[model samples]
Structure formats: C-alpha cells, structure tokens
Target: MCRWLAYSGEPLRASAVLLDATHSLVAQSLDSPMGAETVNGDGFGVGWYPEGAVAGSIPAVFHSVEPAWNDENVRELSRSIESPLFFSHVRAAAGPPIQRTNCHPFRWENWLFMHNGFLAEFAKVKRDLTFAIDPSLYPHVTGTTDSEVLFHLAITHGLADDPVAALTAAVDQVERVGRDQGVLFPMQGTIAVTDGATIWALRYSSQGRSRTLFHSRDVPTIREMYPEAERLSQFGDHAQLVVSEPLNDLPGLFIEVPESTIAILDREGYHHEPFRSAA
Candidate 1:
C-alpha cells in the first residue's frame, strides 16, 4: 500500500504538515513504522487548493516517480503553498509500475481522492471490472490499479449524491465480482475524499485488519495537552488531520478511526459513524 495524510482547517503552509512535523510525511517515506512496508519510496504526490481558486476548483498537483526523500520539487512546493485542505501521499508500489499516471490524489473536478490499500488478487478481476466501468468514465480511468478504478466507479455511481453510498457501492461491486472469481479479502483501504472543506475518510476491508488510519484530536485539546508544542499555535480551534498514522507520538494526539467507519471532518471537530457498506 502507501502512507498518506489529508488535512483541512485554517489555511496554513502545506509544508508545515507534510515536511515539518517530527514524524512528517516525508519522514514516513523513509521510515513509515506503521505500514506493512517501512519505506514507501516508490512515488509520491501532493494536492492542495490555490489561494484564490473558486470553491471546488482543481487543486494544484505535483507528482514524482522518484522517492519523496529524493525529490526537490515536493520540498519546494510544500514549503511555498498555503491551503486550508491538502493531501500528501508516499507510495510503496503494490503491483503497479512506478509512473506519474499511477500516482495518487486522483481528481474529478473539485474532489481529490487517495487510497492506501489494495484489491487482493487484482489481476484476477482487472478485465471484468474494467469492462464494467461506465463508458462515460472509462476514458478517465488512466491508471491500471484498482484504487483509481474505485475512484472512478464512485464518480460514475454518483459522488455528487451521497459519497458514502457511492463508495460503498464501488467496494460492493469489487467484492461481489471478486467472490464470483474466488478471490478472498477482495478490498481494503484508507481513503480520503474532499471538497476543500468537508473530508470523508473511510477505513474498511473484507477480512478487516485494514491498513491503519487516524485523525488528530481537536487542536484545542492538543494545545492544552502540549502547551509548548510550537505547531499547535498555528492552527485554529477547528483544525484537524486525517493521517495514515500518528504524525508524532504526543499523548492523545490522534484517535484511531474505528473499523468500518467513515470519519467526517469539516469546520467542526470530528464525527465517526459505522459505515453502511451499500453494494
């Protein structure tokens, strides 16, 4: 899979979250303690809103086939851009080639999406699922991985309606077909989808034991806990983060997203509810 973090709240430099944290996303590229692979250096990407872009406009994107630790562009861009919402991902190739098209922060208009797990035995179900894609979205399916396909499937099914239900249908479609082909544990992921403000992070898997997904506790709580932590002062009261793992080991810094749950984070604090998988 991969390691990624999605954040939204008061606008701040993207680098502050991705590069400056003690256990920053860049550091995770070299030493991601929580993922199955300690190092996710295959490729990386970052997407964030522009300072004056209209609501839901395409956020700027930077992707590299090089390891994140070795990429200068990411470092420069992260340090310069300020966004209220952004996504950064460092990948460990899970059966796909290292190419820009395969990199994450996949987009459809104002929405941005990233995935950090796999569809077990993808090769077995590739053709069937590809043909199943809606003709309207088939051309936009530029990547071969099941992750991108899942994103488009969600779009095709209706991301504009109910994102949770659309994603549920996408997973159900994958699992339903996988079962017919004798593929076990057909889906697993920690996905982030956002429209600048609200973020929908869903964590689930057929066999459970899905990859780790966590979100920071409210900024006020964290500030009170570590009054000396310099970074806490930069954030607003509603600031929050949804990450693949704890960015740092501060006590009560992050809360584990429960199994089969969709965590909704916006200007408000955070809310978790059991995900009703709909397919």
Candidate 2:
C-alpha cells in the first residue's frame, strides 16, 4: 500500500500540505502511523495544475525513484509551486517495481489520479483486466501498476463525464474479472481523482475492509476549534484535503471516510455518500 493526499481550494504553495503540515506527506512517507505500510520509501510523485490553467490543461507531474524525504527535487518543487489543486503520493510497492512510470498521481488530459492499496493476486487477472480496457486508451497506459490500470479503466468507463459512475462501473468489471480468474478478493484500495476544479475520493475493498481515508473538516470549524494553531491562517476558506491519514493529531479536524463510501469536495463543501456497488 501507499500514502496519498489531494488538496483543493485557494491557491497556496503545495508545501502547505506536503511540507508545512505537522505530519506532512514527507513525514508520513517515513513514519506513517495509520498506513498499511510504515515506510513508504519505494518512490514518490506530485502532480499539480499550474496557475491560469484552463479546463483542459494537463497538470504537471514530478516523479522520482528516491524516497520523498531524501529527494531534493521534491523539496524544491513543493516549496516553489502554488496551485489550487494538486496531489502527492509516497509509495511502498506491494507488487509493481519502483520506477517513475509506476508512481502515483497518474495524469491524463485534465485529470489526475492516485490510489492506495492493491488488486489481490493481480497477476492472475492481469491479462483479462488489461484486455478489457478501451482499445484507444490502451496505448496511453504507460505504466505497469494496478493503480494506473484502474485509472485507465475508469476513463474507459467515462470518468471524464461522470467520475463516480465511471469508477463504480470500473470496479465492478475488476471484481468480475478477478472472480473469473478464481481470485477470492478482486479489488482493494482508496482512490482520489480530480480535474483541478472538483475532487472525488472513494474508499472500498472487495473483502469488506479498506485502508484509512480521511478528509479535513471545514477549515472554519477547525480554525475555531484550534485558534492557537498559527499555521491554519495560511489556507483560504475553501481549502480542503483528503488524505490517507490525518496530517495532524487534532481530534476534530479530520473525519474518516467510511468504508464503501465516496467523499466529494467542491466549492460548496465536503459531503459523503455510501458507495453503490455496480456489481
């Protein structure tokens, strides 16, 4: 499994979440208290939309094989760029080799996607699953990770038009293919995807248990609850984050996204709905 987080709302330096937070992404990479793996040092990546991006602009991605804490480029980029939407992930390989292409925050057009967890016995269903992807999208899937494959599957199912429905359909196909291959549990993981305007996060597992997923409570609520925390001032009212683990120990600041649920974050606020199984 891996650790990841997505940020949306007012434009601020990516470091606000990747570095400045008490238990930042870099900190989580080294010692995650809630992840499936404690050390997510296999590799890391960050994707962010640049300022003035239009609807179809693809976010820039920076991936490296080095551990997040040790990578100077990650440090430099995080501290330099300011974006309203971005994604950061630190990986602990479950099966795929640690390489740049296999890093999280995979991008396609205006979308950015990342996942934490693995497809149970992926090798058993790889052929069947890969062949199910849209023929046109097959050429665009440049990586060899189940997470990246899942992204293309979602796109193939229409993520560009309706993310929730498309992802649900994609998961159903994965589970069906897994069962056909005799695998007991077909899919597992939490997924986060965004279009630089809205964000959607899902927590689910075929076996009925999934990795941790949490989103920050409304910033104003948190500010009122912990007025002494000076760092909270840096974020705008709409700023929000959905992470694999809480960025800090604050009790009321983050809420766990329930298993088999989808959490949506937009200009209005964060709301969650039970995930419907397409299978």
Error of 2 at 48 (Å): 0.5
Per-residue lDDT tens digits for candidate 2, residues 1-279, read 799999988898998889878899999999998888899999999999988888778899999999999999998999999998899999999888889999989999899999999988999988888898999999988889999889999999999999999999999999998888888888899999998888999999998899999998888898999999888899999889999999986798989999999999998988888886766
- Model 1 TM-score on a 0 to 1 scale: 0.97
Per-candidate TM-scores read 0.97, 0.98
Per-residue lDDT of candidate 1, residues 47-110 (tens digit): 8887667775877788898999999988898989888888989999989999998999888778
C-alpha lDDT of residue 267 in model 2: 89
Could you tell me the TM-score of candidate 2? 0.98
Model 2 lDDT vs. the true structure?
0.91
